[model samples]
Target: AIFSVGVSQLNASLAHRIPAREENILPTFRKALDLAREDADRLCHWISQDVSEDDFINWVTGSVRRMWGKKGNREVQAQFESDEGRRSVFDMLINLAGYSMKTKDILKQCDRVVEGAVLMRSLLKKVSHN
Candidate 1:
């Protein structure tokens, strides 16, 4: 219940904070944002369970990789027009990185990377607004 609420809060926060850089891009951005929230919820559920460390690591790796694979020159050209759009994608990745991992060292490193992304997203938001 708490986790669900947290996920909802994050979804609301991200949706509210991350604006589409262009007028025509808002709807597509919302769709992608929703998908990212759903993925985070799913990842949180896995964390709540008594899954093995290996399984948790594997799942997170695969999930992040899938996200990475979806991003590229072609998709970026087609889907995003500004750096804010790119920041939105990383926001989703950061949401995933908030998951609790059985193995601390590896996930800690991953979290560090996500933290950088989160910071970049914030910086980009500031720049976009200005």
Candidate 2:
């Protein structure tokens, strides 16, 4: 009983030292989406003729590239660091695309990412306790 109590106390001390994970991805994602929408609108305005499929593709590519930049990547990394954040990421990925092979693949990958993050967090907690 004394040993277990000491172990628990140690674990508690270590856990307190570890900082809580942040949830910044959702807000960044929302901001990125809004910026993408605005950029797409601007691109549409610049066209003299009827917008074509190519134009739409360009807009999408540009917007995604902008959003997936350094800061956006950091935000995503922050989200993937936490269990709840992973769920938020998974939901965001699901809502971004419709029922398609790409969406399915991303969803599968997201599940793995979430599971991996949870496992890693647990391992960290255990290691800290030890």
lDDT of 1 at 72: 24
When summed lDDT is taken over every stretch of 10 residues in candidate 2, the lowest stretch is 94-103
Candidate with the greatest TM-score versus the true structure: 1
Could you give candidate 2's per-residue lDDT for residues 8-78 as a string of tens digits?
44445446545533454444445556656666675444332232334323422443234444543344334
Highest-scoring model, lDDT? 1
TM agreement with the true structure for every prediction: 0.23, 0.21
TM-score attained by model 2: 0.21
Candidate 2, pairs of clashing residues = none
lDDT of each: 0.44, 0.40
Residue-level lDDT tens digits of model 1 in 29-128: 5666676677788766533433233432343344433444433223323322343322332433434344323236986667656644554344334333
Runs off by more than 4 Å, candidate 2: 1-22, 49-130
What is the clash count of model 2?
0
